[model samples]
Target chain A: MDRFRVAAVVTLRRSIADVQGTTVEQALHALGFRAIENVRIGKYVEMEIRAASAEEAHRHAEQACQRLLANPVIEDYQILAVTPAVAKEVP
Target chain B: MKFGIVVFPGSNCDWDVYWAVRAGLGEEAEFLWHKEESIPGDIDCVVLPGGFSYGDYLRSGAIARFAPIMGAVARFARAGGLVLGICNGFQILCEAGLLPGAFLRNRQLRFVCRSVFVRVERSDTPFTNLLQPGAVLRLPVAHGEGNYYAEPSVLRELERRGQILFRYCDAAGQLTEDANPNGSVANIAGVLSPEGNVLGMMPHPERACETLLGGTDGLTVFESLQRHCTMAVATSAVL
Candidate 1:
């Protein structure tokens, strides 16, 4: 089986309520990170996918994230990477 | 005595814990926000309620472990105070290093909601004193990341110490894979700390506390704690 590492960076959907994000932005301002405004928080997920093709791996990762990782109603996400990047590459 | 339930964003079960502790245990349980700097004083027990804490982002309970209140929870638990975690709270306890193991997506890769049977493995812990070994209780569980994972040596230690509190069981109280909704190691559905005061279980005992809510099997859990506290009070009075 072909395998790929799917990493998802999920953030809140623009329309939904994210009380945590607002609180964080206020805290950052207090810390004097004024330039880092409008900070929205999300999660970075890295998992190995076993599939016959990279495309299938991407689809699997997408399903996993949508069904469990991110709630569809208030959250939206785009697949970040389904490729196994070099170990030294830092994103 | 006062008890506190830590609240997080998207925590759907904070009220459930409140009802269970207040009505079922008859204790004065209060709500604690995630941003709180310290726990309320003279707390007899601390509860970490289940829900999508940190919205279940960055793994089920990963980010919530870094919440401000958790630092206080850890300090209190380490000082021999009682701690209980349910579902996502269980995940957070593991993430916070108050308990061991990690909860992952169900191997079936679907959210599972069902009534499950759990066999009592030990009754020595304060949380399980009301039940006997091998007793079975039916409880409802609903979650996506319920699969529990831990390394071999640690699993062995938990086993040796009787820390494994509950195991998924068959209808006849036999441990079976079919009963384990998630692929938890050794079918472990709950666990306790070395001191027996800290408990983390995926099943929502609080949800089953009242017959009107469908079942009362959860009462034993809180009753066990109440009994222990009552005995302690009497002993102190005599002293």
Candidate 2:
């Protein structure tokens, strides 16, 4: 079986307020970064899975997000990447 | 009446709920470990107390909702058993889908800990049957993510169905913006499930149930539950 590395991003839905993101945006403005606006914050989760194909790995990652990683009531999640894991090099 | 207080890995208020029910309110109460598969048959009510269950990981209560005992809790709730979730317990209830709506980080981005006045929106539910309509209660709410949120349509439904139990208010029972400690929608502090058997609130009623803790206004909540259970038993016997 091939090992795939998966990464996902979970963010609050647009309809809900992102207080942490708003706080960070305000701090950035205070730091003189005027161009930054609507800076939303979210969680980045990464993991490795053993699956036959990238499609299988993606499906597992999606299911994980749906069941555990992301709460659908207020947050949205996206599978960022599902790349095959490379073998480690011997020292 | 017997009460079961579920204890998750990070549950810190299990004993507080125990004391509120066992000592403060004079009821039989016990702790049910999160790993337990089922609740005892004699438990008349289940309480999810306030605390950082599972260390508030992955958005508060998100992880604790999957605890082994939660399956039984959900079944019990579905069977029309009474369930009261306080603070983090409220978050867990929402995450577990036992209740509608979700919590957002406090609008001020701070963990607010103090006594806040909440106006009783309705007194017919099991949680507040002893209280008067629009009664103002002083309860302590300590949490960082108590800002309750729901879709506008859901909020309308909650209002239409009289599911809203408490709303943050001023000492004089006014729904002023300043009285809202966490910017919850419509200043809501508590709500009831569609079946009216499950209740979730952001405030810590157990913490305020004793005079030494500063007020006894919260005692009425527990007392109301006892009264409701007693009345139900009497009615069932008559039937």
Best by TM-score: 2
Instruction: Return model 1's CA RMSD, one decimal.
Output: 15.5
Across residues B1-239, which tens digit of lDDT does each residue of candidate 2 receive? 99999999888889989998988999999899999999999999999988999899888999999999999999999999999999999999999999999999999989999999999998889999999998999999999999999999999999999999999999999999999999899999998999899999999999988888899999999999999999999999999
Best by lDDT: 2
Candidate 1 regions exceeding 4 Å error are A1-91
Candidate 2 yields a Cα-based lDDT of: 0.94
For model 2 the local lDDT of residue A47 reads 94
DockQ, per model, reads 0.03, 0.78
lDDT of 1 by residue, B1-239 (tens): 66788899978888998998888878888899999978777777888988998777667777888789999999989888889899999988987778887765676757999889999998877787899999999999999988877767888999999889999999799988888998887999998988888999999999999989889888898888877777777999999
Listed in order, each prediction's TM-score against the native is: 0.73, 0.97
lDDT of 2 by residue, A1-91 (tens): 8989999999999988888998999999999999999999999999999999999999999999999898887899999999989856689
